[model samples]
Target chain A: MKRLTLALMVLMLSACVSVEYVTPYDPVIDNGIREYKESINTLAKNLGDQAGTEAGTYEANLAHYNALESKIDLLIERANLQSAGRGCRLAEGISAQLAKVAPEPMIQTEEGDSYGCTERLLVLVKDQLDLLQNIHQSADKCNAMASPRGTKISCLRATTSKAAMKITNQSINAVWVVETAKKNGDNG
Target chain B: MSVNFEQVLANILDSAASAFGDGWDSIKTYAPAEFKKISSQIVEIAENVAKYQLNDNEGYSAQTGKLLLQMQRNATEGVLVAVSTLTLIAVQNAINAIFASLRETFNDALGAIL
Candidate 1:
C-alpha cells in the first residue's frame, strides 16, 4: 500500500510538470498582417509601374523590389511564429526587416537624369513608412492582450517600427531636396 | 541668386520645432499626470518633422504643411484621450484653435522664403 501511494504521487507530479503549448489567436493581428501583405503587394506593383524600360534602371529597381518582397515574406513568417506565441522570434524578425529596408543615400549624377524614378521610389518609401506605423499601432493593441513574452515582442515591434518610420522619413526628405534641386537647375 | 534649399529647410524646421515645443509646454501644464508621460513622444514627433528638408515648390510645401497640421491634431487627440476626463470632441474646438495658430505661425515663416 505504501509503494502504491508513492507511485500515484509520482504520477501526479509528472502530470503537473508536463507543459502544453497553445497557440494564441488574435483576430485584429491576423487582419493587420493580411492588410500589411496587401499593402506591400500594392507598393511592389507601383514600383514596377515606375520602373522605366531602361535596362540598367529596370534591373536596379527590380532588385530593390525583390529585396522588399523577400522582407515581406520574412515578416509573414515571423507573424506566423508570433501566432504560435513565439514573440522573441517575431521581434527579431521585425528588427531585421527594419534594418533591411532602411534607405541608402541616392547616388547623385551630374545630369540628374533619373527619369522621375527617384521621386516614385520616395513615394513608395513613404507608403512603407505609413504601413510600419499602422503595424506598430496594431502591435501596441495586441501587447495589451498578450502574454508577457508577447508583450516584449510587441514592444520591440513597436519601437523598431517607429525607428524605421523615422529613418524612412529622413530618406524621403533628403531625396525630395535632391530632386527639387535637380528640377530647379533644369528650369533655370 | 541661387536659393539655398537646405538653409530654408533648416529655418522652417527650427521655427516649427520651437512652435511645437511651446504648444506642448502649454498642454503639459494643463494635462493630467498620465498625459505627461507622452511629452517626450510629442517632442520626438516634432523633431521628426523638423528633420525634413522641404523644397520651395508651392504644391509640395502645401502638402507637407497640411500633413504637419494633421499630425499635430493626432497628437492633440492622443493627449486628450490620455486624461480620460474629456472626450476628443469636447476638446476638439480648443485643440483646433491651437493647431490653427501653430499652422499660421508655420505658414508665415515658410511663406517668406518658400
Candidate 2:
C-alpha cells in the first residue's frame, strides 16, 4: 500500500510537468517564409544590378516593394491567427524557459500579446523589409543627383545591396529553423 | 514484487539530464553561430554606412543617421529572440523526457505490484 501511494504520487507529479513545447507545424508558415526569402533575394539582386539606372529607382520598384510588404503582413497575420489558445500556451512555456536562460531583457512583440515565438519571428522579418525599403528610398534620392562626371551616382551600390540581403536572410532563416523544429515533432 | 521510489526518481533525473544535454547542444550550436552572424552583419551595416558617407559629394546624406541604427537594433533583437526560442525548445524536450521516463517506470512498478 505504501509503494502504491508513492508510485501514484510520482505519476501525478509527472503529469503536472508535462507540457506542449512548440506550436503545431503549419505548412503555410514554412511555405510563406521560403517564398518571402526567395522573392526578397531576387529583388535585391535585381536592384543591385540596375543600380543608378531608371529601372532601379524606388519609384519604379515601389510596386514590388509594396507587394513584398503585403506578403509579410499576411504572414504576420497568419502567425497571429495560429490557434490562439494553443499558441498562448506555447508562449507561456517559452516565457518560463526564457526567464531561466536569458539574462537580457526580453524583446517586445509588435502586439505585446501571448502570440508566441513564431509571430515575433514574422515581426522581425517585417522590420528587415522596412530597413530594405529605407535603404532603397535613400539611394533613389541620392541617385537623383549627378557627380562631377555628369553621370548619376549609384548610391545603392552592389555592396550595399548585398549587405541588406545578408541581414534580411539571417532573420528569415531563423523563422524557418523554428518552424522545421515544430514539423519534426520537437514540440514535446 | 515492489516499486522502488528511489530508483524511479533516479531514472527520472537521468532522463531529464540526458535529454537536456542533447537538446542543449542545439542551443549551444545555434546561439553562438547566430550571434556571430548577427555581429558580422551589424559590422557590415556600419561599414556600408561609412562608405556611403565618404562617397556622398553632398553634405545631406542621412542614410544611417536614424534608419540603419534601428535596423541594427532590430537585427540584434531578432537573433536574441531566436536564441530564446531555441532555449525554450530545449527545456521543453527535457521536461517531456522526464515525464516519459516517469510514466514508463511507474507503469512497470504498478504492473509488478499488482
Candidate 3:
C-alpha cells in the first residue's frame, strides 16, 4: 500500500512536466530557407563565372543583392511573428556559450533578444549576403582604379566565391537541421 | 483496484528507455557529423584564402580573408546553436513520452483522475 501511494505521487507529478524547449516547426519558414539557399548558390555561381566581366560589377548586380536582402528581411519578420515565449532556449544558450569561446563575438542583430532562433539564423544569412556584396564591390573598386593602367581585375575571385558558397550552405544547413528535428523528431 | 508497483515500474522504465533510446541515436549520429562538416568548412576557407593570396590578379587582401574567417566562425556558431536546439527537442519529446506512457496506468490507479 505504501509503494502504491508512492507510485501515485510520482505519476501525478510527472503529469505536470510539460515545458516548451523550442518553437513548433513552421512549414513556411522551412521552405523559405531552402529556397533562399538555392538562390544564394545560384548567385554565387553567376558571380564566379562573371568575375572579371562588366556583369560581375557590384553596380550591375545591385538589384539582385537588394532583392535577396529584402527577401531575407521578410523571412526574418515571419520568424519573428511566430515567436513563442522562451523561444528556443537551447539555441539561445548555445549562442551565448559560443560567444564566449569564439575568437570574435558572434554576429547579432541590433535588436538582439527581440528575435528567436529562426530570425537570428536569417539575420546571419543577411550578413553573409552583405559580405558577398562587399567582396564584389571591393573588386569593382580595384578595377576602377586600375582601368587607366590597363591592368586586369577580377570582381569576385573564384576561390573567394567557392568559400562564400560553402559558408553560406553551412549557415543554411544550421537552420535546416533545427527545422528537420522539429518536424521529424527522432529521425531528424 | 490496487496498483502493481513492479509492473508499473517496469512499464515506466521500458517507456522511458524507448523514448530516450531514439533521442540518443539522434545525438550520436547528428551532432558529430555536423561538427565534422563545419570543421572541414573552416579548414577549406583557410586553405583557399592562402591560395588566393598567392595569386597575382585574383589575390584577396588580408582584410577580405579575415572577413571570410569571421563568417566561418558565425557559421560554426550557427551549427552549434542548431544542434543544441535539436538535442533539446529530443529531450523534450522523451520526457513527454515518458509522461504519456504513464497516462493509462495513472488513469487505472486513480479512477480516471489522470
Highest TM-score among the candidates is held by which one?
3
Candidate 1 local lDDT, B1-114, one digit each (tens): 333445534543443334344333433433433223223334444443344324221111222333333333333332222211122212443554555565556555444633
Q: Report the number of the highest-lDDT candidate.
A: 3
- Regions more than 4 Å wrong, model 1: A1-113, A130-142, A145-158, A183-188, B1-114
For model 1, the docking class works out as: incorrect
The candidate, 2 or 3, that scores higher on DockQ is 3
lDDT of 3 by residue, A41-129 (tens): 88889977787667776778888888888888887888877763223333344445565557655644444432267666776778888
| TM-score of model number 2, chain B | 0.61
Grade the docking of candidate 3.
incorrect
Q: Model 2's lDDT to the true fold?
A: 0.65
Per-residue lDDT of model 3, residues B1-108, tens digit only: 333445533543343234335444555566555555555655565565565568645546666677777777667667655655667777778887776677655666
Score candidate 3 by DockQ: 0.21
List the lowest-lDDT window of 10 residues for candidate 3 chain A.
A84-93
> Quick one: RMSD of model 1?
27.7
